[model samples]
Target: MIPRSRTVSLLVLGAICLAACSSEEQPVQKLRPLALKEQASNIVKSADGYAVTWAGVLSNANPWHFGEHVVATIVGHDAKGAEVVRMDQPLDAVPPGGSLAFTGQASATQKPAKVTIQYRPAQWRQAARIASAFQRFPTSRVQTMRQKDGAFLITGYVDNPYSVPASTLVVNALLRDKAGKLLGGGSTFVDEVQAGSPPRFILTVSGLPKGAEVAKTEITARTWGSTGRPYEDLALSGAVPVHTIKPTSEPFAVDRNTQIVSEYKQ
Candidate 1:
């Protein structure tokens, strides 16, 4: 959600400025140069296993401003190396020739049917705000499994064909057995995708405690957008076979690929 303060500022920027000058103005023209010379700082916060808050301060040549937004995502591997899911919240006005501080929240919970990504370019807001209107579908299934040597692995995907940007989605994963037993013994949090072009993804688990054995497993993934707001939820059984591979084993892993499905738009 956008902060009220920002909404007001944007309104003023758009309204007051239109009467004053929308384009070809000196203050606006100097924005690009000053932005290039601005100093920036970043901060990260965990909202859940799936989401986080990103805050920063950027100072330039003229005024002072602040920004707040939310972001979330999923990270994994493709046929190449690393894959991604992500999305970002709308930002506020920037100070001309001045400094501004901003914050936003992002998530990776595996819930939303469509993936999301953080967009920095000027054209992103219009598209995402429109995409936000898409209906979120249910995951309907989830499962997990463990390798022989104490390492853990999980895999699953949604059936929806809405085709959202790859940058939006926070994936939270947990492994369980056929009898609903905890194999890895706890839930795991993956890193944020921030922003990327994607739909298909496979991620690897790191920093497993020595001697932890994962035999069989079940999985749960919740995905969301700004403020940890869920857009999709996927829960299913038999998603992964437990006790098959060893976490210590390298060959065992996850992979995602985008398949184009056909449908008639009303």
Candidate 2:
């Protein structure tokens, strides 16, 4: 006859082994930090219906690779600043050096609501499902500014309220336009000040020709990290009309005015 104590001991040992194996059998998704360049396009042929394309800009770092179906969602307040569009769709995974666009009814989806798209591997099936049910977006913001002599400088910070780090990014800035044309070349990118440190880059304003007046300016970041490449965050920007008393007399190759103005003309 089997001993009662022996039976109990075997049952407990089997249960412990089963628990350990169960934990090992579970899968995990690759949640890597990535940055994306998002550009909106009017993919829809007709002007009436809703069709917008969100293109991704793959960078040398954190390239987008396709695996399983990635989900897209947009949530934002309507014109009245009330909750408007809240859309979600399962899109095909975007491979490296690829793009993703969407066409849908404006009425069916949230108009101005913040949008997001997320994904992972098929083994970790829940990647598409956890969903950005949370309604927190990295809002637009300006931290500081510095302009002197012929040099203009800007500083700011962007906060990603998402789970992963936004690696693919484009700082969309209309750098000091003058005479109805863009003046000065500018660069926007993150630089690693120190090894193992995240990233910190500044936007510089330089190279404006003389006699040009500062028209308007705006800066935004295009990040593919968002669930779906969301619209450029205009809300996260700051601009100041500056009058250069010292006027940047640097001539941009003698100022080639479109129809043509060049003291050293060809």
Candidate 3:
């Protein structure tokens, strides 16, 4: 019973109001990008050209989310500030509430005066359980040995804290100086780390500046995948029994008296 033009105008107005209300009810979500905590690079003269090695640490500010499929672009510039070489390094996932230490190598025809790095935004995924259960891979019996060539050989045992077995995992080692500055770093992989049965790993770090003194070493472990499917599956499997302590009300006997000992001669 209304004119056609007026009816069309009222319909358009009603649709705009509905759209405005819908937008108000469901707003777009904004995510914060991952932060680059620290980074370092080394360039050495090679037989053909220059060999470049780089290390970096990516930090996830979100404690309850995992940063997936992050990529780093390394650029090498000559003294003239011209790009000589570039490499795209795909890195592993940054665990929730933790940092990821990664290393890579590349070859350049010309030596670069300095190198720079850039990172791609990571896709965020919320964790199914506590971050510690799936992401925390503990290391023990870690021993660092310095070689005559000024390189370091790091050996250690990595334990599985989840119920699922990790077919493969990456272990990273960072060498620091007395002032807590990173000198160099390296990585290694381990296979078949089962619950209650850990595997041993050996990593080597080299390409440091002359007379560089290493005062300490830092080691870390994580699952090897962009999406961390192994860790995610472990989380869905439920909580694991990380502790072996037995709880009981019954009392146990203990000998508190000290006995005299006799020395034996060979």
Each candidate's TM vs. the true structure?
0.25, 0.28, 0.81
Candidate that would win on lDDT: 3
lDDT of 1 at 86: 47
Query: What tens-digit string does per-residue lDDT give for candidate 2 at 218-262?
Result: 454434433332312211222112343675677676445743744
Per-residue lDDT over 1-266 for candidate 1, one digit per residue giving the tens place of the 0 to 100 score: 99999999999888877887745546532222223221111112234543332323333343221111322122322234434334444433222233333333345443233322233422111112222233332233344444664444555443332333222443433333356443222222232322122233343342244554444433333243322222322111111222566678565253322222222321
lDDT of each: 0.34, 0.39, 0.84
| lDDT comparing candidate 3 with the true structure | 0.84
Worst 10 residues of 3 by lDDT: 257-266
- TM-score-based ranking: 3, 2, 1
Q: Point out where model 2 deviates above 4 Å.
A: 1-146, 176-181, 191-201, 224-266
Residue-pair clashes per candidate: 62, 21, 0
Residues 147-229 of candidate 3: C-alpha lDDT, one tens digit per residue: 99877899999988777788889999988889988777999999988877889999888777768888988999988888856
Q: Candidate 1 vs candidate 2: which has greater TM-score?
A: 2
